[model samples]
Target chain A: MQRIRLLKDRIARKLMLSLTIFSGLIVFIMAFGLYQRSRPILAIKPLNELLFSTSWQPSSGKFGFFPFIMGTLWVTGVAIFIAVPLCLFTTIYLSEYSGARLCKWTNPLIDLLAGIPSVVYGMCGVLVIVPLIKDHIAPFFGTFSSGYSVLAGGVILAVMIFPIIIHVSSEVFRSVPAELREASLALGATKWQTVKHVVIRKAMPGVIAAIVLGLSRAFGETMAVLMVAGNVAKVPSSVLDPAYPLPALIANNYGEMLSVPLYDSALLLASLVLLMVVLSFNIISRIILIRVERNIR
Target chain B: MDRRYAEEKIFRSLTFASTVVIFLTLAFILATVIAKGISYMNLAMITQTPKGGYYLGKEGGVLNAILGSLYLAGGATFLAILVSLPVVLYINIYSKKESKIAAFTRFSFDVLWGVPSIVYGAFGFTIMLFFGLRTSLLGGIITVSLLILPIMSRAIDEVVRMVPTELLDASYALGATKLETALKIVTRQALPGIMTAVLVAFGRGIGDAASVIFTAGFTDSIPYSLFRPAATLPLAIFFQLGTPLPEVQGRAYASALILTSIILIISVVSRALTGRFTRHVVK
Candidate 1:
């Protein structure tokens, strides 16, 4: 009986360890799958040509990814610019100034914001942000936008990432020891100065990691960005210009256009690009976060 | 001193104002969805599927999507738990505390957790093409399971890691096998956390639209089998809002409301149940 029980335990351990190994392998498998699907287009066109070409005429078998790549960059860039400052301010306030009661209310509210579906954000963007941009902001800049500009997408994405950036940044801020803040104050630094010269300096790496994670989230955001970003296949010259992001390109054209030869490959290549970029950003951010945690300890 | 105090006040207000802006934004989104959603909501909206000329202001409902989202998220969460529990249990219970494999597994999950749902959709679409599978509920479930597996594992792993080494040693002192200790003691110790993780993953799976858009292949009717195309709430809203008709657009708000309500309920219930289950937890 003892031997049988021991044998059973060994078998169970082997089974579980194998399952764990298999789970880790899945990320590589997904990357491989995307790459394999994208192989045809890679074979047909040089990678540089495929990535940098301006034209996106898929009908004649010309599939240039430059416009979509730029579109993703522009929208994500604008989102980072808007979100980072606001999030930093909010995090500073929450961690340094706010009372525990305020945080008690604010944290759950932030979680709720994060939990709101991206589709709802898209719908809200259509109703509110798009019209605000089309009628107000664009005209203020002396330009006419149909409300579906890269600016609109950026605004919506910025809002979608607000919860993420704020949540991560608040945790980062909290990790700065109380002793450090007290020490700064003992040296006669004002509250703002303490935050600026002490807490912010200590938490800079963590803040950057938070922002990078937010960047990855913004880059891979599909439905909300797709709904607002005017799916024009051009490199946007300004925030007000309509642009088609890579995820939008894939989401918009994938299932419906299998008949278009090389179209599937083109879209799959877009997916591969998204996968690589987002994964790298995530890995970088994770490394930074690990380092920050080690330093905090 | 005067200059320093003035600068501090200005910066303080700026931060406070930004914080207020976030709160106002949250309030605005909630109010808009609720007000617009309530205006169009009726019993039929949740009881019947779309009918002929539905996008043209004709009578119909999003019952198909409501049910389909439930089925798809439900199945995916189940599969994710099945896979996640084993992987996490193996890491926490079966492996050395500082094992490289355990560390690597956790790292991979972190990366996977960050992967976008659209990539998953595209990857799922590619896999379907290879297997000659059309968009179906099965595909959606599989893809969503992949998307949520990491989320479930990481959440569960955090809690399981907190299970004290002393407890495991005690179990082993009683001659309990590793498998028995894992399944009986560590799992029980982490039950409340596990409950929250499952609900969180389910809420995520249900609200996600991008991963399912290509794999599920929306239909007007409720899906009857795994092989059949299924309508989901987010896609239902997407399609309805795409139409030019005002009535259809109104219905889309109604659908969004339903989706939001389901997620809200899941969160609330998770919190409540976690509290209740803590009675059984060791700590």
Candidate 2:
């Protein structure tokens, strides 16, 4: 019986080890596949021109991705600007001020928001936000408006990433040692003062991580932005002007690849760009989180 | 002292206002979807498939998309669990905490988790072309499984990490093997979390449109084979909402309502189940 048990244990151990390796292999395969498909475009298009030029006429074979790149950066920058302050404030209230009853109800509601489908956000943007921008905000500013523009995409993205930023930042705030809060209060600090000075200072790394994660989400987001961002492949002059983001470019044009000479490769290159940007953001945030965890220990 | 006091008051009020904004945003999204969706929702819409000119605003229902979403997400979640469980177990049981391989694996998962669904669709599209495979249910399942693998694995990994090391030590002291301890003790302790992870992945997979739009190649009829293209709820909404007709746009909202309710149900059920298991957990 002892020998039989030992054999069983050995077999189980080996099986699990192999499975772990297999998971790593899947990541490798995906990266390899993306690289292989993107190679054709990379070989033909000079890297500098592709990264810097705004012209993207695929039909005539001009595959400059500069405009889409700028579009993505602008939309994501706007989203982060809108999301971070609100998320930080909400996290402060939830972690430092709210009672247990309020936390219970609001916590689950936030999770539900996080679980909401992106396409639904797109639908809402189409029916509500786009019109609101076109009919009210644009005319109020005395600007010509299409409603489907960079600002619309940014607004929808801001809503989508609110839950993520709030969740992460709140967790960071909650992890600050209770003793720190009490000591600050004993030193005659108000609740808001303690949170601002002691709690926020300690949680800064984690909060940065949260913001990075939210930025990563905004950068890679597709459907909602695609539906609302007007998909004009040009460098926009204003927030009200239409723009085409990188992921939107790939999604919108991937289907018609055969009609253009290098369309498939161009789209694949866009995917590779998205994958690299998102991966770098995630890696940076993970490093920050690891440092935070080490400091806590 | 007076300036400090004023600053505190202003900051506190600002945070309170932000919290209210968050609540209002949630209320607005729910109200818009529900109000617009309810008028077009009916029994026929839920029970029948598209007939003729469904996209042209004629007639039919969304049963095909509903059923297709179920099949695609269900299969993908099942596949993800199969791949995630053993890897999670390996991390907690078979590997040491500071092992380079373990650390690297976790980092890779974190990166994968951040990868967007559209990129996954592009990746899947490339692989399908390489394999000479067309868009079908199988393609969607494979793509979505990749999309959710990191999510499910990371959730399970966190839960398994929380399993007190003392329990593992005790099991070993009793002469139980690592396999036995992991399979019996750790799994039971982490069961609720694993279930929650699966449900979350399911919700994400079902609601995603960009990932499956090209890979699944939307169909009006419910797919009967793995090789056949499948319709999904998000795709259904996308197609319907793209129409120039008003009634079809209403149908799009109705589809969103159904998708939202399915996700809501999964969230509630997972929370209830997790609560039940919390009582048995050892801190």
Candidate 3:
């Protein structure tokens, strides 16, 4: 019986170790699989023409990714531009100004925001933000829009990512040692000065990591952006103009992808682009986060 | 001196305003979903599947989607736990704390956790094509399990890592093997956290639509087999809203309300169960 127990223990350890190894290799497998699926498009169209040309007539075998890529950049850029300051301000207040009771009360709310489905956000955008923008904001700016524009997508996405940015940067701010704050106060620095100079400075790298994580999330958000961005298939000249992002392209055109020659491969290539960009951003943020954790230790 | 004080006041108010703005955004989303959803919600919407011409504004329910979401998320969560528990256990129990392989494994999970659901959907489609498998419930479960495994494992690993080394040493001195100690002591100590992680992953899997859109082809009827197409709530909302009819769009809001209510219930249940399970934990 003892020998049997020993054998069981050995078997369990080996099983778990192999599982761990498999988990580590799964990321690479996903990337390679996506690449293989996208190989047909790469074979037919040169990389530069596929990436740089603006025409997207799939029925005629013309698949240019430039407009979609531009749409992604514009929307993500606008989202980050709007979200960063709001997230920074929220993080500073929650970490430094709020009482523990207040912070405790807020934590669940942030998690709730994070847990809400993307489709619901999209619905809310359709009901509220879209009409507001089309009726009020665009008119105020002396522009015409259908309310389904890059600005609308960016606004909704900015809100969606607020929880991610706040949750992370607030944790980063919390880990800034209390002694550092106290020491700054003892030297006659104001609370604001201490926050501006000491706490923010100390948490800078982690804050960047948090923002990068949010950026990656915004880059690949499909449902919410797809709902409000109008899926226009054109590069927007302004925020009010309708634009179709890469993820939106994949989601919108995927149903009939098999009917058109090379269409499926093109959509698969879009996902590959999304995967590569998101994975790279994740890696960058992970490196910064690991370094920050090491320093905290 | 006056200028410094003025600057402090300005910055403080700005930060306070921003914090309020975020809270207000959450309130706005909740209120909008509830208000719009309530007007269209009905008993039949939860009890029966879509009838013919349902998309054309006929009467029917999202029972097909409701049941499908439950089964897909449930199966995915179970599969994820089966895989995640072992991977985390290996790192925390079978390997050294600072082992290079363990660190690398954690890093890979973190990266995988950030991969987009849409990409997962596409990759799942790729795998399906290779196996000559059409879109079905099994594809959704496999894809969603892959999507949530990193989330579940990382969460459980964090909790298990907090189990004291002294507890393990005591078990070892009592002639308990590492396997026995892990199953009996460490798992018990981390039960509450593990439960929370499981629920969190389940909520994510259920709420996710992009990863399942192609993998789980929508059906008006409930899924009865793993190989059959399954409809999910998020996709139901998406398709319903895509219609031109106001009534159909109203149903979309109703479905959103249902999804939101489910997540709220999950959050509450996770907290309640955590309290109940913590009775046996040492700390």
Best candidate per TM-score, number? 3
| CA error at residue A70 for candidate 1, angstroms | 1.0
CA shift of A286, model 2, Å:
1.0
What is candidate 3's CA lDDT for residue B118? 94
- Greater DockQ among 1 and 2 belongs to 1
TM-score of chain A of 1: 0.97
State model 2's lDDT: 0.90
Per-residue CA lDDT of candidate 3, range A1-297, in tens? 888878889999999999999999998888899899889999989989999999999999999999999999999999999999999999999889878888989999999999999999998999998999999999999989999999999999999899999998998998889999999999988889999999999999999999999999999999999999989888899999998999988988768999999999999999998999999999999999899888988
Clashing pairs in 3: none
For model 1 chain A, the run of ten residues with the poorest summed lDDT: A253-262
What DockQ does each listed candidate score? 0.81, 0.74, 0.87
Which tens-of-lDDT digit does each residue in B101-186 have in candidate 3? Answer: 89999999999989989999999999999999898999999999999999999989989999999998998999888899889999
TM per candidate comes to: 0.98, 0.96, 0.99
Q: To one decimal place, how large is model 3's interface RMSD in Å?
A: 0.7
Candidate that scores best on DockQ: 3
Candidate 2 per-residue lDDT, tens place, B27-103, comes to 99989999999999988788989988888887899999999999999999999999899899988888998888789
Off by over 4 Å in 1: none
**What ranking emerges by lDDT with the best candidate at the front?**
3, 1, 2
